[model samples]
Target: MGIIDNLEAMRAKGQDSALMRYSLGNEYLKQEQTDQAIEHLAEATGQDPNYSAAWKLYGKALTQASRYAEAVEALNRGIEVAEAKGDAQAVKEMRVFLKRAQSALDASG
Candidate 1:
């Protein structure tokens, strides 16, 4: 089985968690399946609201789907979480992505 299959099996066994969802989302993103990625990433963030990485990936998936407004929202939340956690790197990266989403929003208007 592939990575996704293995991850799904884990979930099937009631092993689901924020990290597992994040991994599944990351794998889906790697496959360019933005919808799947978004779904799992959203769950990841829901499962752990303080998960900066999940929020970042969720924002990225939204951005990839051209959901600029949602991307901005997620990224802003991720930045806040990262800041509170003193994760400078994550905060910086989310800011860059936030800028991209803002630019997309501007261009579409």
Candidate 2:
């Protein structure tokens, strides 16, 4: 079965967790379903506010959807979470995405 099928099975079994939601979000992002990705990623982040990876993906999905302001918010919060967790890689990645989102906002306004 495909990833989504497996994920759906997991969800059907009520196996909801931050990781599960994050995986769903990532899968949706891969499919270019930014809205769906945002929904899952938001749930993931809400379930675990310290989830830097989820925040990163959430920001990226928002950016892909042209929601630069929200992307900036997510990225900023992600950077803080990453810093707190000593996840330098995540912080760096989020910074890059943060800049991209800022640029989009600048260009649009």
Show how many residue pairs clash in every candidate, following the order shown.
0, 0
- Residue-wise C-alpha lDDT for candidate 2, range 1-109, written one tens digit per residue: 9997899799999999999999999998999988999999999999999999999999999999999999999999999999999999999999999999999999998
Per-residue CA lDDT of candidate 1, range 1-109, in tens? 9999999999999999999999999999999999999999999999999999999999999999999999999999999999999999999999999999999999997
How does model 1 score by TM-score? Answer: 0.98
Q: List the residue pairs that clash in candidate 1.
A: none
C-alpha RMSD of each candidate structure in angstroms = 0.5, 0.8
Once fitted onto the true fold, the runs of candidate 2 whose alpha carbons sit more than 4 angstroms away are: none
Poorest lDDT segment (10 consecutive residues) of candidate 2: 1-10
Global lDDT scores for all candidate models? 0.97, 0.97
